[model samples]
Each structure stands twice: as structure tokens, then as C-alpha cells.
Target: MAMTAGVLALVLCVLCFAGFWLGRQEAVRIRSGGVQPHSLPSYYGSYVALVCGIPASLALLIWISAADSLVRQFVIAGLPDHLSALPEGDLALLLTDVRNMAYGRVPLNTARPEIVGAVEHYLRLGEISRWLMWLVVLALAIGGLLLGRRMVSAEFRARNAVEQILNILLIASSTVAVLTTIAIVLSLIFEALRFFAKVPVTEFLFGLTWSPQTALRAEQVGASGAFGAVPLITGTMLISVIAMLVAVPTGLMAAVYMSEFMPGRLRAVVKPVLEILAGIPTVVYGFFAALTVAPLVRDAGMAIGLNVASQSALAAGVVMGIMIIPFVSSLSDDVLNAVPNSLREGSYGLGATQAETIKLVLLPAALPGIVASVILAFSRALGETMIVVMAAGLAANITINPLDAVTTVTVHIAALLVGDQEFDSAKTLSAFALGLLLFVVTLTLNVIAQRVVKKYREQYE
Candidate 1:
């Protein structure tokens, strides 16, 4: 069916192209006879092509989406009475096995006769559906092409029609984007509400213990869960603070140098090389943190007569900071460069030194963007999981000290959902609660950043 659909799409594309060519040629032939077209030849072509393709494409999509369900119904209706009378859940499972066997994903040798007959019926119905889909879609395409060609006169207003269609398409795309975001937020809210029902909001928000192990059976030992989330929140802040401390100053200085002082040739070379850090995979950074930075941090702490865990927040934070440097530097560099040279000249006109002018004038002017970049970097730090998982152990310790093993909300969220488990269980549903918390925190940060930016922007502008 997939192959048939692909072929149908290719055929529709070729027909649309033919419509475009014929429409364009007709407009040119009219112009050769000295009649001015209502729009450009290209507009005429686009109108015909869109008319030819749109109906066919929509029909094809609807057909393919409905085919499987229609085929399933037909096959089930033809099933023997005993099989058809099974409970909905059991019937669904039986259909799944039938599909697997039909697709050769499972052995058919042990299959019962009714199951074999159902599989054959399913395949036959699917094949008929594919043929009907092709005929209906192609007929629509041909009809649309003829109708469009007949409408393409010198007064057809093809450009206005094309632009109207494009506007509708753009609005639809934007609507889909907005709808998708709403759907995601709604899903998170619903699932998190389920979790909150199982665990109280106050305990989740303020509880210090972080263990989420629930007993599978009544006799299991030490499986009573603690859903307190304070420790996870504390660990997240510890790592993110450390990361920002490392990233902000280093990245800001690099941005300042690149935008203001560095030679153009050297800046060109250094910028791409620095940005390359952002391209390296996070898992690779995790491996580097575990094998290289963690041991180094442990050794350094020991040499200073201090205790540090083998997997500590400090190692993860520092590595995460290094990873986000490019994000900060790239944005800050663009912002700094956007600061008008006239501002620099005005400061220099008053005999301000280069360092002093940058400190007072350029920095103030670019403050909003700089703040935005730092906030972005902080968000990046907060969301980091692999580095934390590999270098910072999932201990969920509520210590301010970076040398302690810790875990972020993201790490715990991932840990909670890693293996097979009951979806209704608090252990699994807790991941959604953590996700909601993270979303709220991120949204709050964005609001704060916007307020700060708005204040500074009004002053600068």
C-alpha cells in the first residue's frame, strides 16, 4: 500500500507539472498574438498546478488514512462467529497477531484456520482499497486540470487567486504550529494532574526525599515511595548555577573580544571553530565528562584535601557550560556588533578609553540581548541530561556543594520512564509531574527575561 501511494504521488506530481507547462505555454501563445495577460506566465502556471495537485493530494491523504480502518472492519466482519464475538480487547490482540503473521513478522505455521482466513481477507481488502484510491485521485487530478485550463483566460486574475491560496496555506501552517503546542501542554497538564492525584502537590513541591520505588507486591521490602521533589530541584539549581558561573563570563568575554577588538581575519577563523562545540553530540560530551573531567575533578579535590564523589555535579556542570559557550558567544557577538558604531564614536568623542567605552556604552546598549543569551544558556544548562546522567550520579542529594553527587529533574524524569512499567503507577506518572515543573520553571524564566528585555530595550531605543 505504501509503495502504491508513493507511485500515486509521483504520478500526481507529473500531472501537476504538465498542467503548469501547458498553462504557461497557452499564456505565451496569447502574448505572441499581442494580448496582454492579466498576470505573469508563472502565475498562470502556478494556478493550474495548484488546482491540479491540491484536490488530488487531499483525497490521497484521506484515502490512505481511512484505508487500514476500513480494511480492518471488512476483515473483522467476515471473521467466524466465535472469533468475532470475543471481547474488544481480545479481538484487538487477535487482529494484531493476524497482522504480524500476514506481514511475516511471526510464524504462520502454528496459526489457526480462522486467523489465516482473516489475514487473507485483510490483504485482499487492502489491495482493492489501493486500486480504488488510485482511480479516484487520478480522476480528480485530470478534472481539476481541465477545469483550470478552461478558466485561464487573459482576465482570469491568476495572481490574486494564487496569492490568496498561499495566504490561506500560511495561516493553516501557523494554526497547526499553535495547535500542536497547545496539545502538548494540555497532555502534560492532564497527565500531571493524574500524578498529583496520586501524590499531594505540597509533598511533591516541598518534600526532601526523592526515592520513587513503589512495591510491586505487598510483601516487597523497602519499596514504599517518597515523592518529595525538593532534592531534585536543589540539585538542578546547583548544576545550572555552576554552569552559568562558568559559561557567562567566559562566553561574554569571548563575544566582546570578537565583536570589538579581534582582527577580522582571526575572528572569522575563531568564530566557526568556537561554534563547532555546539555541533558535537551531547552523548559524546557525556563520555568526555565521565572519562576525563570527572577523574580530573576528583583528583584535584583530593589534592586540595577535599572530598568529592566519583560522579559529581561539578564535573557535569563544567562540561555542560563548555557545551553552551557557543550559544552564548554567538548570540552575544551578534548583539554586540549590532550596537551602533556611532555610540562608540560618541564615547570616544568624549575621550573615553576603549575599555571604558565598552564597559559603559556598548555593554549598556547590548544589555538586553546579553541577558537573553545568558538566560538561553541557563535554560540549556537546566535541560542537560546525558552529561548529568554520565558524570553527575542520580543520587538526588540536596547539597549546595558542587562536589556532591546529584541529579536534576530531567535526569530523574528520564530514569523514572526508562523501563517497562505500569503507566498508572506513580513511578511512571511522576515523569509527567517533573515535566510540568520544568515547563513552568522555563516559562517563568522566559517571562522574566522578557520583562528585563522590555525595560532595557525601551531605554536603549
Candidate 2:
């Protein structure tokens, strides 16, 4: 079908070009006869090309989209009522078998007449559909070509028609993007609601314990479990805060020096070296944290008479921050560099030193972009999992102490869905609840960032 479609597309392209040539020559001959056209000869040719291609492509898309489901229904009609009434999973497997047989991917048993007949019908219908598409599409392309040529005249508004079609295409693309976002949010909401139904929303939101184990029977020991999300939330915030503390000032100051003070050659060398941090795999960062940094942190803590777990939040967070530095520095450096040199020059004209000028002028001008970059870096730190899993042990401890082992929302979610899980289980469903909570937090941060950006933008621009 794909090959056939490609062939049809090639044929249509050739015919559209033919129509363009004919229409263009016609317009030229008319213009030579002293009749002025509303548009150029090329515009008339383009209009004919659009006529030949657009409607034909649209019909092809519509037919391909509907063909599979319609053909499946036709095949299912010939199957036994027992097969039709089978459980969804069983019916799905049967459908797969039938499709495999139809495609000669499976050896069909001569003993089953109904299955054989259904496979034959499915293949036959597919063939008929392909032929039907080829005939109808080619016919439409020829008809559209003639109509476009007949409509071509001195007064035709070919450009206007093309523009309207372009506007519709733009609107359709935007609608799809918005619809996709809505679909994601709706799915999360539905699943989270299912989770909340089984576990009380209040308990899940405010409970301090983080166990999610449920036993198979009431006679089992430790059958019931706690689902408090406070520890996960607190641990996420703790690691993210530590990461920001490491990333923000360092990344920002690096950006400032590179964009403002460094020589061009040094700046070129250092910037790439720093960005190399971002390119190194997170798993590498994880292993580094686990084997190298975690031990170092433990030794440093003991030497200073402070107790620190080998897999502590500090170890994970410091490594995670190092991973995120490039995100901040690259974006901030670009933002600061993008600030018009005119602004800096104006400050110098007022007898401002380079340092003072940057503090009072360039920073303010680039504030919006800096804030956006920091927010992006913060989001990355919040979502980081591998380093946390490797360096910070999966203990949901609600402590702010960086020396303590802790787990984050992402780690918790990953833990909950680690193996084959029943979707209806509160244990599995809790992942959705945690996801919803994380999403809301992220959404809130985005809102705050947008407000900050808007306020500073009005002042700067």
C-alpha cells in the first residue's frame, strides 16, 4: 500500500506539472493578445498545481484512515459468535492471528474453514480497497486539473484562494497541538481519579509515611500500607534545592564572565568544555556519584565529625547539579550575549565601570531570559532519576539534611512501577497520583516563571 501510494503521488506530481505548464502558456498567450491578468502567469500555474494535488492528497488521507477499521469490521462479521463474544484480550489475540494468516506470516491450518474464509476475505477486501483508491484518486486529479484550467482567466483570484487554503492548514496544525496537550492532561486526570477513589485523597496528600505495599490476603502480615506523599515531596524539594544552590550562582557567574570579561579564545575553549558536562550520559553521572562522589562525601563528612550516609542526598544532588550546569550556563550565556551591545555602551558612556554596568544594566536587560533558563535547569534537576537512584538510596526520608539518604518523586514513581503491576491496584495507581502531583507542581512553577518574565519584560523592553 505504501509503494502504491508513493507511485500515485509521483503520477500526481507529473500531472500537476503538466497542468502548470499548460495554464502558464495559456495565460502568456492571453496576455500577448493584450488582455491583462489579475495575477502572474506563474500564479495561474501554481493554482492549477494546487488544484491537482491538494484535493487528491486529502481524499487519499481520508480513505487510508478509514480503510483499516472498516475492513476489520467486515472480517469480524464472518467469524463465529463465540469468537465475536470472546473477552477483549482473547479477541485481540484472535484478530492478530487472522491478520498474520492474511499476510502469510503464519501457516494456516486446513482444519479451520471459518478462520481460512475470514483470512481470504480480509486479503480480498484489502486488494479491492487499493484498486478503488487508485482509480478514484486518479480520476479526481484529472477532473481537478481540467477545472483549474477552465477557471483560469484574466480576472481569476488564484492568490486569494491559495492564501485561504494556507490559513486553514495553519489553524489545523495549531488545533492538533492543543488537542494533544489536552489529551495528555485528561488521561492523567482519569487515572489519578481512579487512584484517589481507592485511597483517600486527604491521606495520600498529607500522610507522612510512604509505604505502598498491599498484601494479597487479610491474614498476611503487613498487609495494609501507608501512602503518604510528604516524604517524596520533601525529598524532591531537598535535592532540587541543593542542585539549584550548586547550579544557579556557578552557571550565572560563568555566563557573565564568558559573555562580558573573557577573551574570545579563552571563552571559546571554556564554554565548550563546560557544555561537555551536559553531553556526558546521566548514567555516567550516576556511576560517578555512586562510586566516586558518594565515598568522597562520606569521608569528608566523617573527617569533619558529621555523620553522612554513603548514598546521601548531598552526593546525588551535587552530581545532578553538575549534570545541569551546562543547561543553565549555555542558555544564560546566549541570553546575556543577546543583550544589545548598545545597552552596555550606553552605560559606559555614563562613566560606568564594566562591573557596575553589568550589575545595573546588562543583568536587568537579560533578567527575563536568565529567569527562564534557571527555571529550565531547576525542572531538569527535579526530574533527574538515575543519579538519585544510584547515589541517593530509595528511602523516603522527609529530612532536609543533605547528609541523609533520601528518595524523590521520580524515584518513587519508578519504584512503584518497577515490574509487572496490576493497573487496578492502588499500588500501581499511586504512580498516577504522584505524577499528577508532580505535574501540578511543574505547572505552578511555569505560571510563576511566566509572571516573572512578563513583569521584567515590560520594564526592560
Candidate 3:
């Protein structure tokens, strides 16, 4: 049925194009006879094409979406009264399986006559829907062509109409992207709400313990899986701090060097090398953190007589910080470079040393962009999963010491969903709640970054 509907829709579209060509030919003939229209022949063609295509295409889409459900309803009504007694949800599932079986994709396990009858009805209804859809599309296309042909005349302003339609279509296309973002956020919000209902928001927010594993069977014994998210939050914070410690100075210095100090020939060589850091996959970074960096950190800590887990927050955080350095340096470098050369020249004319000019003038002027870069880096650090999962231990220690093992929220979420988990369990729902919290925190940071950028622009302008 879907294939039939698609083919019919394609036929209508081709016919619309033919109508457009015919309209253009007629318009050219009129112009040759010295009764030129207000718009060019091609504009008339587009206008006719739009008229024939848009309405028919819309009708085909609506029919395709509605046809299956409508057919299923009729089929269900024809089913035996005993079959109708089943709950609507179960009935829908059974019908779906039966239809799948009828299509030869799968077979129903049950041998009930009602099920067999329903499948047969479903197939017949599908055939009817296909035929009806083709007829509707043909009618819409023909009507649109006839109407468009009547409007083609010397006084017609086809170009203006076509442009107006295009403008509306462009806005509609852009709106779909914005609406999709909104829909995704709303879905996250609702799922998170369901999670929060199972666990107290305060406990999820501020509890110190971080264990999320719960007993699978009634016979199992342990602390009813600690949902205290504090450890995860602390781990995230600690890793972010470590990342910033590594990234900020290195990234800022690199930006400063690139913008104010490096000669062009050297800059060309160095900039691409630095940007190559940004292209490295996070999974590759994870392996480096897990295999190379974590062991090294463990050995270094042992040498210093400090207790460090093999997978420690410090190792992951440091690697993550290294991963994000390019993000900070590149954005900061561009913003710094955007500052006018006049500012540097004036500072130099005033006898300020190059270092002094960069430190006092350019740095302060580019502060907002620099701060935005830091916030963006921070968000990335907080949201990082692979490095932390590979290098940081799963144990959720509430302590802030970087040498100790810790679990982050992202790692916890990943662990919870990695296996088949019952949907209603606190362990599973906690992932959604954590995701919501993550989203909120990142969104807040982004909003603040935008505001800071705006303030900076206002100050400079």
C-alpha cells in the first residue's frame, strides 16, 4: 500500500511538471504574438508547477498517513465480537502482528480463526486504500492544472505570486528545524518528570551516595541501590575543574600566541596542527585515557605515596581537558584576531610593550569571547562520557580528591542503560532524571554565555 501511494504521488508530480511546461509554451506563444504577460514565461511555468504540485502532494501525504489507521478501524469492526472484547492496546498489538504475518514478513504464533480473518480483512482494506489514494491524487492534480491554466493571461503577475509562495515555503522549512528542537526538549522534560516522580528531586539533587544498582530479585540483599547523585555530580565537577585547569591556560596562551606573537609562516604551520586535536575521536581519547594515562597517573600517585585508583578522576579529567583545548584555543583565537589592528597600533604608539598591549588591551577587550569559550569548554567537560567511563572508576565516592575513584552522571546513565533494564525501576528512571539535569545545566551555561557575549558587544560597540 505504501509503495502504491508513493508511485501515485510520483505520477502526480510528473504530471504537474508537464502542466508547467505546457503553460510556459503557451506563454511563449502569447509573447511571440505581441501579447506579452507581465511576468516572464519561466515564472508562469513555476506558478503553474506550484499550483499543480503543492495541493496534490499535500493530499497524498495526508492520505498515506491516515489510510492505514482508517483501514485498521474498518477491519477491527468486522472482527468477531469476542475478539473485540480484548483491551484496545492488546488488540492493536495483535492486529499489528497479524498484519505483519499477512505481509509474509512474520507469522503469528496463535492459530485463532479471528486473527486469521482479521489479517485477511486488513489486506483487502489496504488494497482499497491504495486505489482510493491514486484516484484522489489524480483528481487534485487535474483540478489544479485546470485552475492554473485559466489564470495564465497577459495581465497575470505570475512572478510576484511565485516569489510570495517561495518566501512562505522558506519560512516553513526553517520553522520545522526550530520546532523539532522544541519537541525533543519537551520529550526529555516529560520523561524526566516521570523519573522524578519515582525519586525525590532533593535526594537526586543533593544526596551524597551515588550507587544506582538495585536488587533484581526479591532474594537479593544489599543497600537498596543508593540513588544519591552527589558523587556523580562531584565527579563531574572535579573532572571539569581538572579539564579547565589544563585547558584554560594552554588554550588561552595558544590563542594569545597565535593572535599576537606568531609570524605568518609559523602560524600557518602551527594552527592546523592545533586544530587537528579537535578532529580526534572521543573514543580514541577514551582508550588513551584508559590504557595509557590512567596507569601513568596510578604509578605517579604511588611514587608520591598517595592512594590513586587505576581509574582515577584525575587521569580522565586531564585527558578530557587536553581534548577540549582546541575548542577553546580556536574560538578564542578567532575572536582575538577579529579585534581591529588599530587597537594594537595605538597601544604600540603609546610606547606600551607588545606583552603589555596584549595583556592590558586585547585581553580585556576579548574577555567576553574568552569567557564564552571557557563556559563552552566547561559544558563539554560536564557532558563528557567516554573518557570518564574508561578512566574513572564506577565507584561513586562523594569525596572531592582527584586521586580517588569517582563516577560521573554521564557514566552512571550509560551504565544503567547498557543492559536490558525494566522501565519502571528506579535505576532506569534515574538515567532520565540525570539526563534532564544535564540538559538544564548545559542550557543554563549556554544562556549565560550568550548574555555575556551580548554585553561584550554592547560595551565594544
Q: Give the TM-score of candidate 2.
A: 0.77
State candidate 1's TM-score.
Answer: 0.88
Lowest lDDT 10-residue stretch of candidate 2: 215-224
Query: Local error of candidate 2 at 24, Å?
Result: 6.7
Would you list the rank order by TM-score, best first? 1, 2, 3
Q: Highest TM-score among the candidates is held by which one?
A: 1
List clashing residue pairs in candidate 1.
none
Residue 154 lDDT in candidate 3: 80
What ranking of all candidate models by lDDT puts the best one first?
1, 2, 3
Better of 1 and 3 by TM-score: 1
Per-residue error for 449 in candidate 2, Å, reads: 1.0
TM-score of each: 0.88, 0.77, 0.73
Candidate 3 structure, TM-score to reference: 0.73
Query: Lowest-lDDT window of 10 residues in candidate 1?
Result: 215-224
lDDT of each: 0.91, 0.88, 0.86
lDDT of 2 by residue, 113-139 (tens): 878888888889889989999998889
